[model samples]
Each structure stands twice: as C-alpha cells, then as structure tokens.
Target: MSKKDYYDILGVSRDASDDDIKKAYRKRAHQHHPDKAGGEEAKFKEVNEAYQVLSHKEKRKQYDAYGHAFEGAGGGAPGGGASSGFQWDFSGGGFNGGEGFSDIFGDFFGFGGRGARRKTNQGEDIQASLTIELEDSAFGREKEISLKRVIACDRCNGSGAEPKSETISCTHCSGTGEVRKQFRTPFGTMAQNTTCTECHGRGKVPKHKCATCGGNGIKHATDTFTVKIPSGIETGEAFGVAGKGNAAPFGGTVGNLYVSVSIAKHPVFTRQGDDLHMKVSVGISQAVFGDKVEVQTLHGAINLKIPAGIQSGTIIRVEGKGMPRRAGYGKGDLLAVVNIHTPTKLTRRQKELLEELKKENL
Candidate 1:
C-alpha cells in the first residue's frame, strides 16, 4: 500500500520550510495524541511518521527528489551512496525503527521521557496601605479596614466550573498542561513548550464554566479585616495577614495580604523612637521661681514640676509618660523643652517696676 504524503498529513504546503513542517506536525501531534480525550492514535502515529521523514535535512531532500519511492524501498540506513536514495545514516543504530517513536516525540517536544510536571495554581499576593493616628501607634490599637480585591467565586468555590458539570481530560494538549509547538522564525524552525491556552494549563476542561467568574474562578470583591497595630510601629513599616489576599483560581493556596502602615502627623508632640518631645512656654516670673505645669502625653495630661532658676532651652523629663516600648520593659520619658516668654507689651506699672529695679541694680 502507498504511504500518505508527509506534507498533506501535516496540513502544510508542498514547499513548506523545515520549521513550518515541524510546526504543523506539533499541532497535529497534540490534537491526535492518544492520551487526550477523543484522541486518535492512528492519526497521531501518522503525524509522527510524517515528521520523521520531513524533519531531517537529508531525508527531506531525498523525499523531495524521489517522493515516496525513497521510503518505499526502505532506502539505505543513514549514510550510503547517493544513487541508493539514502543520503544519511542513523549514526549508531539509534533509529532501529521499533519503540523509537516515544524518544522521537520526546526529543521533538522536550518531554525527556514522559513530560514536565503539572503547574501549580497558587494565588498572588496583594498590598494595601493603612493610615492611623499617631496616638494609635503610641498605644497599641486594633483597626478594621476594607479593601477591594480579587476573591474566589462563591458559587463554584474557585473551581472555574459550575456545579454538576463533568470535567474531562483536555483535548487540546491530551491532558498535558503544556503543549509542544513548532514555529517558523527568522532563525529556523524552533520547538517550544507553552502552557495550554484552552484549559489555562489545568489539564482538564469543564463542561459548563462558572457564570459569575467567567471560567476564571475569581471575582472583584470588597472584604473587611481587623488588623492589630503594635505599639512603636513606625511609618513605612508593613505587616502580613495570612490567607487574606487574592484567592487562588483552581483550588490552590490562598495568598497573603500585606498592610503598609502610616502614622498621621501629630500637632502637639514629635516622636523619636519611643520618646515624645514637646515645647512648653513659661512666663519670666515662672522661669525665675519654681512652678508646676501640665503637659500633654499620648495617654492624657500630666503634671510636670519646673525647678527654680530655670533657663530657656532647658529640657525637663517626665518619667514613664511617653510612648510605650515595644520590647523589654519601661516606657519612654516625656521630654519638655522650656522657653521663657518675654513680655511683648508691658503695662505702665510693669514698666515702672522694671525701671526702678534696673536703676537699683545699676
């Protein structure tokens, strides 16, 4: 019986280039692979046989010159006399022509022996920013935040298919998540392994796709979560909450949610590490003599004593009154910087008293 034409089997033109021939053969191989649903073993074998003859440079030349006559006569091994219709040899009995089909397809598709491993379906992580009052950071607080992100479909539960739908092995890649394809480029016919587009590399096809997610198994949704703000957490720092990010599409692990924190600027105090610094103004009389004053802290107002003969730019400390320390023990002290307020406008009695004092001192 006459063998099928190699070019016709691959659905390519008679003058197809070596790369084009390989590409055509690759698509046919996946389409007819017996491992896939509705696969045709005979057609898959025919495709491989056609590629075997047309893929090699010397074999293609012979096939082009002598047509099926070269293969019909069994040709000569790999290398022999030109007139013998065999221009090349299998080198070292490599192509014994029995059980070499697997190796040949393996080499053509980069399957090594069987094939590459199936891909994982882990979800992607998401990031968001949270702003809080400085007091919230000074003393630990819990905050509830809402965010819009991609979440698993509640109807299908991230499966991508509707309930009661039957899943079958993929027909496009024969249940392989990856498909081996050949393409014609400027360089030459190059073979590549790509994720199967039909099933999105899931190796299975759903009879009915989920209507809500459109077979993506996810949807945009708003979710609420409560986050703990640890004391002493500075701005630009981030914390992670497990399984709070975008949900995986096909039953994979859920990703994490990263929350970046920012503290709003405070009007009364400036924070450095765990310490709070503030400026306090006193009258000249209060500075000259001892006085007691109230200062603001993160918690509440506290009394601070001013010693006699205090000068401007003097820093007074109120122990255990500042922000709480994150680790170890004691709270930071509140630093009060004193500035003596000189009278801008003096009354006549004050002017007279100052003049008399100055004269006595002189």
Candidate 2:
C-alpha cells in the first residue's frame, strides 16, 4: 500500500503549524464522532493518525525527514521487532489478534458497521460528565440525574394499533410472513422462499392504531434516577447505571447509562492516581535551617516538618497522607515537593545576611 501524505489526510498544508494541525484534527474528529451520522471509525482513525503525527513537532520533523521508511524504524504506526515502545505482548498467552486495534480504532471507519449500527437497535450507551468535589470522590456520593428521551410509544402500548383495532394475517404471505414458489424443471423441481418485506415477518396488521404513541407502546418521557459514585474513585473512570439510556425504538432493548466522573480541580492539592502532590513553598531560611510547617490536604491542614537544607524540587513523603486506593484497600503516599522563596526585597541588614550566606555556597 502507498503511504498517504499526512497533510492531505488531515486536509492541512504541509507547512501548517502545530496549532493548525490540532485544530484540523479537532474539527475532523467531531465530524466523524460515532454519535453523528457518517461518522465511520476508520476515517476518524486515519484523521487521528494524521493529526497525531503532524501535531508533534519532533514526530513531524522525523516523518518529513524519513518518510514511511520509518515504519519499522519507528517513524510510522508504532511498530515492533522487539523495540516497539507499544505493548506487543499478549496477556493470557492467547490470540488477541485484531481485538486490541479494533477496540480503539475499528469503529474509526463506518466499514466496521454491523456491531456499531446494531448497537443503535440495542440503544446507545449514554455518558454524562459529572463534576464532584474532591471530598466527594474520597467519600462516595449519590447523584440524581433527570433527562428526557424517546422510549417505546405508550399510546398503542407498543402494539402499534388503535384501542378498537383488530389484527389480520397478511394475505400476501399467508401469515407465514414469506411466500414460497415451486418451479418445475426438466431436470427436477426447484423451490424458493421469499420473505415479505412489507409485513416484516409480523404477518398481522392493525385496523386502528393508538393515537398517543402512534400505535407504539412506548413514549418519550422525562426519566429520573439516582446513581451512586464509589469512594476513592478517580476522574475519567466510569460508573454504570443499568437501564437508564434512551428507550429503544420499536420495542427494542433499553440502552445503558455510563456516568463518567470529572473531579473538581483542587485549589491546594493535586492528585496523581492514588497519590497526592503538594508544592510546599517555604521561606529560604526555613528551608535552609529546617522547621515545622502546616500544609493543607483533602482531610485538613496538618503539620509537616522540613529537614534542613531542603532544595527546590526535593520530595518529602508523608505515608498514608494521600488518597485511598480506588478499591478501598491500601492508602497512597502524599508527596510534597519543595519550592524555596527568596526575599525579593530585603532590609539592608537582611540583605547583608543573605549575601553572606550566598558567599558560603559560592
């Protein structure tokens, strides 16, 4: 296969800037998102690949300098020969084959349509962005979400018929929903069966249809449900609320609702996985001479002792001071990185002491 021009794939100029490439990718991804029509996963993935390469300055430079020859050489799709940074090993020692690739990019092209489209008949899983305070994530919380969506029509009660209506078998297919014919030939006999597309195999037609749901049993309705978010949950992880998505059309199955968490950004502390990060800024003298200081955490302000001669970027860990494990098991460590503040403007005598101290290091 010929290598496609990255710029052409992303519909950008060869000389486009990183931001331009990013903008193009965002536009294209949104257009091809599975939620929208014609959003084939394959096309979307190609666009992603184009953007991934062009948006990175170093990667772009390498590609421009080497071309597709970079495949095994590490310039194209992350490859392998025992050197690919990508995970190449199979877990469970079984054939995962294309499962991993399809999991992320198969739906990129609408070519992967059967499962993706039938998923519509199955109803789509809906995701809601939920923001909770940091404390809420540490200790679980229950949230009630209210929304409206199309469900089975309720007027006909999914029967697709009027209250006084009667059903009759389809004459065309003789209630079989299919028509069969025998064609006698010189050699022998030939038989063929054809399904009646009109009745769609139901074989019955209603005399009158329900007005409210237009003969369908379900209806569009506002639904409300409370979901419990587990404690120690990390942002971006999802929780499932069963039978909460839009009702399937034509009496199909209801979709599931997946609520993705977005933890409110903290003002004082930052979290990485189970661990917490705190940048404790200290006075230059306090850092050099060591002293006890108070710091804020998700729980509360706690006293932390600093060792003498603490340097910027130095890390001090407080065991079990961080967040709890997501599974409610072991606790994480709170790591404090140091930042020493030097007085910008000091008294004449203060300046003299600092200058003398600098001379010692010098």
Candidate 3:
C-alpha cells in the first residue's frame, strides 16, 4: 500500500502541539489497537510512527525539512522502523484494556512507557559491546563512549511549546479536539468522527512555538558517558550504567545502560578461566641438575625451583600469579611448561666428555 500522509493519518497540522499529537495517538490507538478484535496493527504502528517523528526534535526537523516523506538519506529513518521491515503490535492503552502502549510502540521506537507511567519499573536496560585491555578490565577502568540517540531537547524541556507561552482553545473541534464529518457520498450522507486536523485532538494550541527546539521538545544528539568498569571483571561479562538509556517522554524516568566486555589478547601469556599459561625454556644441564629460574607474571618476575632430573614437557606451577577470582575466592596458579634446549655444536673435548657421559648413563 502507498504511504499515508503522516499528518493526515494522525489528524494533525504542519505545526501541532505535543499534547495535540499525544491526544491524536490515544484516539487512533484506541480504535486500531489490536485488542479491539477488528483493529489493524499496521494502523496502530502508523500512529506510533507519527508520534515518534513529531515528538522528537531532530526527527521533526528532518520531517519538516523533507516534509514527513524524508528519506533516511543513506541510513533510513533512524530507529523508527520507517526504514524497512518494521513490525507493529497493538496491545496497549485501553485497547487491550490492561495492556500498555509501551510494548506496542517499542516494537518500532526504542523509548518506553505509554501515555503516563507510574513510579517503579526500573526502566529498560541497554547493552553495549565494548573492547578493553586485560589491564583495564583487571584493575577497573573508566571509558567514554559516544551514543547517538534522541533525548529531550534542552531548549523545550519536552513540552514542545515555547517557554512562558500559553495554549488556547482549538478552532476546528470547537474545543472538543474532535469533529464528525458528514459527506454526501453516492449512497447517502456518510458521517465519521475523527480527530481534528487543526489542533490534533488536543483542544488547544500553543500561543508561541519554541525557537530553539522549534517547539518539539526532543533533540537528536550525541550523548557521551564515561562508564566505570569494576575490577575482576571477566571477558564477555556485562556491566550496568544507570539512567543512560532512552529518556522517557512526558517527564518519565530515564532508562539504563548495559555494557558487554571484551578483553584484548596478551602477547606472551594466555588466559584460561583465571589461570595464566606460558612456555619456559631451560638448558639441558639445568633441566637435569635442578635450578632456580625467574618466571614472568602479570605482577612481576618470581623465582621457581625446578626438581632434579626434570625432562622436557614438564609443567611447573607458580601459585597466585593469575587473575584474581570473582567472589573473593582464591586466585589461580600459572603453569610454566618447560622446554629443554640442546647445543647444536661442541668442541672436540666437549664432544668427548658428552660421549663419555652418555656411555656412563647407558
């Protein structure tokens, strides 16, 4: 099907109030909400799309610049699902009677809450994948990440109206914000009750529009937050950043952020579960005669004693040289696999001595 004019579908005007758009959404969502038996999910989504666009400042600017038919340029319509392959489920508001609008609108837009939200509901948490070094992950770290999203426009404060301005009665609905249209069709005079286009079913209009945010309270911005990662965190582990997710519309609480960790690969040492692994090379004489050697670890080099007559492929354990275990448990041990090196060439006397020693051993 062809795309419907966003303003026409929502019964709003080129310049409508946020309250107007909200009332429009509630009206259509009530009728087209999936719980209504004959309701259409697509129509309900169209309503959400209209709100997501008209309610956000950057999106509204793009819509205003391109007139609701804005192409996403190269990327598509941000996260509104207007890009393509969008799904619409309507079980919110009084449509489901007990269902919430948040679920239905969330299918397209990322924000949470519908109409008005009560206290509680810790807000939705968002997960982000961040790559850090083992040193950083081990000792705890602070990092700044850039998040591109729609937040409340600093200029309008989510009201979408100019500050110090007032709202007056709507002209189209005669203060009802709704109107019943009567048209003389081929059959007879057909009448339909729909939201008013002039005031968007709000029954009011702002006397002045905000110049900074253009009367739309939300702005498209790059939000940067320095996330603090706790020590002793393992790879692929997750952390939380409170109140960092999408901001709730209509003065609701902000959402949270979740970050997934990825530690970098070490050059000389390998990690397995909390233990470190490394290869140690020793001369043939030292392997056979037992010697004390210095081993490398994350902290520093430590001395380890090798047993007499030790052979190649032998593993030596150095306790407490690995990563700290979670839950305050004991740390892991480092395993040093020994490799015995042989002399490639020897003098006549050395060769004679080696041959005599080999014969004696035999």
Candidate 4:
C-alpha cells in the first residue's frame, strides 16, 4: 500500500506555517490519546509520526520535494533503510535532540522526556471579598478582614525541625528530590522522573520533628489584618496584599492575598462612573419661579439653584460635588434631576387660589 501524505494526515494545507502545523498536531494528538475516552491508539501513533517529519524544516523540505521517495534517500526515517517500514520511536534522541519534544509533551501531558519535576514549594493563593458602603468608596478607609489560612509554625520557626534537631538528606531519592520510572504507552516506553513521594520533593527530612506542628512546618490559624480601600474604587475591583496568603511548607515562598471589593447599593444616590446622580423634589411654585434647594450629595447637602421655568426631569450639574476621581486630581460632577411635586389633595382656599390664577392665565 502507498503511504499517506504528511499534510493530509495533519489536516493542514501544504503552505501551513510552523505554528499552524504545531497546533494541528496538538489537536490531533489530544483527540487520539490512548488514555482518553474513545481514543484510537493506531491513529495516535500516525499523528505523532506525521508531526515528527513536518515539524523539522529540513525533513519537511525533503518530504515536500521527493514525496515518499525522500525516505529511500536515508532522510532519517524510522530505520536505517527505507524498506524497513515506518515505526514510532520515542526512545533516546528521537525528537530533535529531545528538547522540543520534551517541551511539547510537558505542556499537554504534565510530564517531559526526563528530569521533569513538579513544583510544590510555592504556597497557594487566597481569595477574599470585602463589602463597603458607597460613601466609604467616596472616601477611602481601612477595614479589618478575618480569614482562616495556613501560616508558618511558630514553634519550628517554619523549619520543620525542633530547636536543636538535626536535618538529614532524603533516603528515597538520595537528595535529588525525584525518582526515575518507566511508563509503557501505545507509542513506546517513556522514562519520566517524578517527585519523590517519601520526601515530598523537599530532599530533606528532620531528624526530630517539631512538637507543635509535627514537622509540617505550617499550621492552620484564623488571621485578622487591615486592608486599605482606595477612594473612588469601583465594585468588583481587586487589590492584592503580598505575603499575606498561605505559607509554603518547610519555609518556602508565600503566596499573595487578593481582596475583591463590593459596594452596597445606596438608597438615595446612584453612581455613574465618577458622577453621582440623585433626584431633587421642587414644589410647583418653586419650578415656576426660581428657588434655591438643598440637594444631597455623597459629601453632604449643598444648595443648588433651580432655574426659573425649569421643567421636570431637567438635570442640574453640581461641579466638584461627586465621587473623588480615582485616576486624576479633580472630582466629578453631581447631576440633580428636578422632580415637580404636584399635590393630590387641595384645600378649599388652595382650590380658590388656583381658580383665580387660572382666570388670570398665570
């Protein structure tokens, strides 16, 4: 039988870029991986074989020019001779001196060619939330938050050893923090170095464990700390505090704490970006004639002049009376919407006055 074309196998065009070929290979490999559900082992090997030739510039150039005849010219096919037929070899130096293939496998499979170690020293990050009033955002304030997190053990000083105890190298991995193992997959046998289970990748064990923390180097505790909320901070904005998260075991690097702020809804004022909006009620007479009215703002109540013959729903801009500008130096304006108050019930004298005004056309 004739061999299939490499481009057709990868489902890519003949002029596909190097990046496009790599992406296609990853997609095909993931789809046909033997460990996945409904995976086809033979198709998986075919995809790997196709990627092996196309990913290399020189091999790809030869394959494009000579087609299957390139293999007869000893273009580094599976075996030394072209008649030996094609085979998948993932053993020593099979993938471009192993670096490129190692990176590709490490990204998707979480394991590389050899000497791949899992990173466990860094502590996990913590997420928290803080609720504040809208007024609090107008003016910055410091708030105290409480949360339970992992902290370094006080008794061991985060060393996982007693005050005078001695430290010794791990016997399982001989201080290398990793152990070599061989895995048999559909492609071939793969050698992978995994983290040593006995030492947990630390490569050391305390001769005498700490009494309080039992050599864990960490403890669970409820911590309280103050966080500063900046002025004009919007809802859902997050601020980070360094070194306030969980502490790594055996005194490794500490993670960060991210706090998301949420602003409570105000009963009177509505915030639009940096601008504050509120409705100010005016009497019918006040709307007909000019009048000064007290308007509520985030800062305080201020006197706002109502223009003569002002119509209902008219917006009056009050400069420098809104929320403080979070990015710049100046404050935003407060928009006051005018609402005319119409009396539902009228007394006899009020009705008579309206009758006289109607007759005069006022």
Best-fitting candidate, measured by lDDT?
Answer: 4
Cα deviation at 316, candidate 3, in Å, is: 2.3
All models: lDDT?
0.72, 0.65, 0.65, 0.77
What CA RMSD would you report for each candidate?
Answer: 17.8, 17.8, 15.7, 11.1
Candidate 1, pairs of clashing residues: 78-88, 78-89, 79-88, 79-89
Poorly placed runs, candidate 3 (over 4 Å): 1-124, 156-216, 343-362
Model 1, 158: alpha-carbon shift in Å?
A: 1.9
Global CA lDDT of candidate 3, please?
Answer: 0.65
Candidate 3 lDDT for residue 139: 56
* TM of each candidate vs. truth: 0.59, 0.49, 0.52, 0.67
**What digit string (tens of lDDT, one per residue) describes model 3 on residues 1-362?**
12666788889887888888889878987888655888886676667667666776755665666652333223233354444223232222222232233232222232222211122223345668888877675557788888765567676686556888887777778888667754332112323344565555567756676676565455667898798876667788998888887654322366788888888897767778778788888877798899999876777888878888988999888888877776686677788888888888898997898999999992
State the TM-score for model 2.
0.49
| Residue-wise C-alpha lDDT for candidate 2, range 168-200, written one tens digit per residue | 776778787656543332212223343454344
Q: What is the full ranking by TM-score, best candidate first?
A: 4, 1, 3, 2
Q: Which of the numbered candidates is closest to the native, going by highest TM-score?
A: 4
Q: Is candidate 1 or candidate 4 better by TM-score?
A: 4
TM-score of candidate 4 versus the correct structure, residues matched by position = 0.67
Task: Indicate whether candidate 1 or candidate 3 has the larger TM-score.
Answer: 1
Error of 1 at 236 (Å): 2.3
Q: Which has the better TM-score: candidate 3, or candidate 4?
A: 4
